[model samples]
Target: MAHPDARGNPCSSSSLPAREAAEQALWRLMSFYDTPLADLDAAMAADPAWALPHVMKAGFLLSLTEPTLAREADAHLSHARALARHATPRERAHLQAVQLVLEGRWHAACRVWDELLIEHPRDALALQWVQLWDFYRGDAHGLRARPARVLPAWDEADPLYAHVLALHAFGLEENNLYPQAEEAGRRALASNPRVPWAVHAVAHVMEMQGRFEEGSAWLRQHQAQWAEGNGFAGHLWWHKSLFRLEALDIKGVLRLVDAHLSGDALQITLQRVDAAALLWRLHLLGEDVSAHAAGVLADWALGEGCAGDYAFNDVHAVATMVAAGAHGQAEGWVARCAERALGAEDARRTNHLMAREVGLPLMRGLLAFSRGDADEAVDLIYPVRSGAQRFGGSHAQRDLIDQTLLAAAALGQRRALGRALVNERCMAKPVTPLTRHWLEKLALPEAAQA
Candidate 1:
């Protein structure tokens, strides 16, 4: 007998215990908690003939964006495929999507999930996976639109309703819909305070609006909920560090790095990305972060095998290398990225297009800035500044490019350009202390009044 999942979607599992175990794993995954894999293993052990657990396992591994894990993911997908004959249409669709993901076709996989959602609007697994890929692809429109499309079909009393609201909140925040985003995020927290993604979405709204103090207070207020035993703890700490950076509290940012962002804790690529981004920000502010950068660089283990697999990861790898003063390695990595982006075989991959159009230039610009070629940095980054979203990251993550370009303009003594960029930022948000400091550094006429 097929079991209906939490959302009443039929799952291809005859064993009730296996179905229950898979549901628990799905909850853990949707909540961003650790140990989903263990539950999944239990599910598979409960019923080796079930396909849903195998499909879920494959999706989880593929989402990590680690090339080395592809084979293991493929193995799981094969198990799911072998059981496809007994699977429901939804389960079969999931198998197809995982296969696409293993093929390095993320966009197509997302489409498969999209179609699945259209047919099964209550499929929380499909909703969560697609939202993550939308984020990874920098599809702000898809982020906001997809959730909006499926949200009406979700009942507020559903177990995963808060998670869906949190996803929508992030999408809204990413699209610059601050007020609506905050309202939705607060609503999610009101429903369930442990939703870290809701906490993260609200934080993005604060960061973008230059609510530095409020942002710090917000993260600190939710520290107990988001920090303990949560997979997103490192990223929440990174958000706290961003607030500290804006306040010019370099020491405080360093303290956060030491406490949460470094050492053995930096195990995953996401955590490493956050560490490198924080370190790179410090480096841009004229701070000597060589020691920390060296640690992050060492953990990156950059090699030909992983090169250009994901443009976002490649960009951060280069940032780590540059911050560590490994200019030679950084240059080589950039060259490799260029070669991969141009290679005929890789040209069909989505990441190749991202690398060629945005990632390569951003890497080159960061390298130029590190090498004291401010003019080259400005030239390389300025043209792509508006479309930096193409490279895939939140506005906060992409701000490093803006910061670098502004710094390049000021340091290179390009008066007109420097003033223009300064004014642009000032107009975007109220002049924070950091913006005032940049004005002073640029010797803008308004610096005296600021």
Candidate 2:
């Protein structure tokens, strides 16, 4: 007998309880809350033939992006494939999509999901999965536009409608649609205040608009809602730190780092990258945070075996090593990236090109800055500033590269370049004290100062 989920999509689980539990878990994953992996375990134990439960398990594991979890995803894939012979076409399509993900073909998997949605537009699982893959690939347009494509197919009565709205909110923000993004984010939160992604979307709006004090307060007011059992806690904290940095609240930023951002999240690659980024921001601003840098670098040292797999991680690893004064190791990581780019997969080859074209130069520039070669750093970083987004980070994260270039220009007394950059930044935001400070230091035209 064929089973269906709440939306009447074919599922392989005949057990009603198991199907409902798996559906709940999918919603939980979409909300960035801890999933019910144990429930799927129990469902599989009760009915080894239930394919959708295995699909959920495998999908969840693959989404983690932890190298160790990849093996577990493979095991689940084997089980799901064996049982898929008797499952419905929808279940089989999902199984195939997940298999592509397991094989490291992210874009291929996204295409599969896209086709699946064309027929079964209410498949929340596929909708969320594509959004996740889009984020990992840094597809800013896909982030906002994918959800927009499906807007006509969804209504407020749907169980996961708020999740879709939150996803759209983030996509809009990433695409630089701040006003509309905030409207969508607020709507999502009104539906469910616990939607951390919506909160994060609004945070991005405030961050980009230079609403530092308001951004800080927004996160703090909502901290209790998202602080527990949420996978994005560290990331939200990282956003808060950025707000503090902009406000020149060094102590507040350091406290957030010590109190929340620097612990277990370090074990996760993406979160660890956030930690490295925050610490690098502090280092760039001349804050003495050797202890924090040392701890983060030690964590990176432990994960050095996985270097060069992703250009994004490689650059963060370089930041960690450079901050710790491991100049040789930093260069070695860049060399490893060079080797990986040679025969990389189609999905990863773009990242490889990004590493070669922009990441390597930016990293070398950071390294030069660390070694007191500000002139060389400026010479290296200024040329490739426009291409930094190709390296697979958000606008906020890639801003680190530009910040390093500014640092080099300031230190090397490149007055003309520094004045122009400062003026550009000041014009973008109406009330940026930090940029104003730089303007004063440069003794540039007061008309350029905000």
Candidate 3:
């Protein structure tokens, strides 16, 4: 009694009502909105023998990258594995992928999903999960390639087609294909105005292109659709703040921080990561953001036990602590990252390699920058700048590392390096007020002369 899901893939559920509920959850997951977990719970309760629902739930929880949710995700994985006898081959492959993620073999799980998609190209769940982990692992090439591979097999009229486009759009943007990325993202929005990821992709294109005013307007134009009833609202607001920062609208940026990025409203780690990044940027610009930094630090401190699980999270947590002036706490956080990198049990995980290679140095450099050891910060961070992608974040997010190095060069009176860095930035984007400010701070000549 197999049932076809929204994407026309055969699911194991026999009950119509259960299938409907699962479809609802799948839509929620695709849109990054509403309560997918509740819908998933209902689906599983209605058909206890169904394994796809359990796999779906497990995959969603694992995507959060929070160690506290790992146990819950594992429980769902166990349920899916126990019912493997009843699962379709596609479903069973999903079970194996989830198991690999649970075991901290993210790259392996991605490969499993790749194989599954080759067999069942319309599996929306597989497409979404693999794209997510690809982003998490900083495989920018895979981000674009994975979705591009299965997109031709997807019917244009399918409901999930637009979401697939959104995924591909993001991938293209990550790989620096700005024109193609924007085109794909707009096409997705044309199909479904409520697609946050499409909106996010377009936003990224504008952000990278230094179209600050247009980026601000674009986000605001779609704010009504993505600003509520979703988990991604805080991040959208954070993106808006970046536009504001570029315009040197310091007051406007602070207003957004107060209204949305305060880290006081939501307890999600991703939101807090945005908060730390925004606050840290302001700190770098010589603004007194100690109060906001302290609030973000408090939220991160509550999850202190999960510090070393992911290098990206660990770096953000350390950034918050450093920006908050918790020097001792920042040191301890770096120590934990070092410990995880060297520990026998953690050594086998993909994140351990990430920590050892890039995370530890970045965190230590940030701490040094905070402590006024500008030369030491420059020494530590300059070497890892090119490889920062290994720690897994968008180009905009990883720009923090470069920003720190530039500031360190200026502070340490490394005049030649400072001028070169400033020149590089000027060449990348049209010089804005912020660029001029940086130039002035470093006492460099105007953008043209530099």
Positional deviation of 135 in candidate 1, in angstroms? 0.5
Summarize candidate 2's per-residue lDDT along 1-450 as a digit string, tens digits: 677788878776778777767777887888778866877777777678878778878888877666567778888889888888788888888898888887767777888988988888888888888888787677787788778888778878877888889989989988889999999999998998888989998999998888988998999888998988888888999999999888878898899999887755576777888988988878777877667877877655345335555667777778877776778888777776666665545444345566677777877787788889988988888888876655666778877876777777777868788877876776667657666656665677773635
lDDT of 1 by residue, 376-425 (tens): 99989888888878778899998888788778887895768889888988
lDDT of 3 by residue, 120-144 (tens): 9888888889998888888999899
TM-score of each: 0.98, 0.92, 0.97
Instruction: Show pairs that collide, candidate 2.
Output: none
TM-score-based ranking, best first? Answer: 1, 3, 2
Positional deviation of 73 in candidate 1, in angstroms? 1.0
Best by lDDT: 1
Number of the top-ranking candidate, with TM-score as the measure? 1
Off by over 4 Å in 3: 301-304, 447-450
TM-score of 1: 0.98
Q: Provide the clash count, candidate 3.
A: 0
